[model samples]
Target: MRERQPCVYILASGRHGTLYIGVTSDLLARLVQHREGLLKGFTSRYGVIRLAWFEMADTMAAAITREKQLKKWNRDWKCRLIERCNPEWDDLAISLGLPPLRTIEGTR
Candidate 1:
């Protein structure tokens, strides 16, 4: 079995688009759920399926704290944060071996 690694992540609808911040113990599984539209809520409703940014935490508590902090951040600050690591705002899930997400017309 794989050891659990907590992570704080940000999802986006597109570059400079709607953003959602969350924390998960299994990043890959969570990303897959979001990508497949299985987890119903803000992300599914807004089409925020692209993995824009992420950070690993020492523990689930730490990841949750960081997620709260990011959630409170303003849009500009959040965008800058994502840009620092992913300038193009590309779907980071692809880097994790998941297939590239299909682009929906007008979502960008």
Candidate 2:
């Protein structure tokens, strides 16, 4: 939502579902790419496009370090971390001006 800045974010397929951690300078653009399936790999393959959680950092190096630390966290820990700020596991990007995710009948 703010000007391009270092950020660490977590994406999930659904609540307590598959998770992906990443770092980016332009979070909004990166989120758009993920939602559009433009960035091929884990996110697109696993349908982990929900912005479950995120935190901005003062510097790129700090964001990268935080991302690395979060990547090493166990699944439960990661979920807890997300829940702390986002108990509903809502798509935070939508609140940041991105459109809400369109749901498929049986998909999460």
Candidate 3:
């Protein structure tokens, strides 16, 4: 199997809406879970499934540390970070080497 990518991601309902910071090796799979509401709790309840921002890391520890740090960040700082890499806040599924939502919309 291919090696996993360590990444930190920020999901949000929309601009200036609820935000969720996370780290995962399987970003694509995790995103799918979020989209499907399979991972309940904070994200599902707040509808924070939009892929707003992310950063690639070389190791899981780095990604986790970044995630923890980001979680402690104030909202304004987090928004600034997201805007830096994803000004438009587009869905980042493709960047993570995942198929587009169009490909999944009709299937189970």
Put down candidate 1 lDDT per residue, 17-79, tens digits, no spaces: 889999999999999999889999999999899999999999899999999998888999999
- Model 3 lDDT-worst window of ten: 99-108
State which candidate has the highest TM-score.
2
Query: Candidate 1: lDDT of 11?
Result: 94
Off by over 4 Å in 2: 106-108
Candidate RMSDs in order: 2.0, 1.1, 4.5
lDDT of predicted model 1:
0.90
Tens-place lDDT per residue, model 2, 45-104, is 999999999999999999999999999999999999999999999999988899989988
Pick by TM-score: 2 or 3, better one = 2
Model 3 accuracy (lDDT, Cα) = 0.83
Error of 3 at 68 (Å): 0.9
- Backbone clashes in model 2, listed as residue pairs: none
The global C-alpha lDDT for each of the candidates, from Candidate 1 onward, is 0.90, 0.94, 0.83
Count clashing residue pairs per candidate: 0, 0, 0
64-108, model 3: which lDDT tens digit per residue?
999999999999999998898888776776676666544334321
How high is each candidate's TM-score? Answer: 0.92, 0.96, 0.83
| Candidate 3: regions farther than 4 A off | 1-3, 94-108
Rate residue 74 of model 1 by lDDT: 91
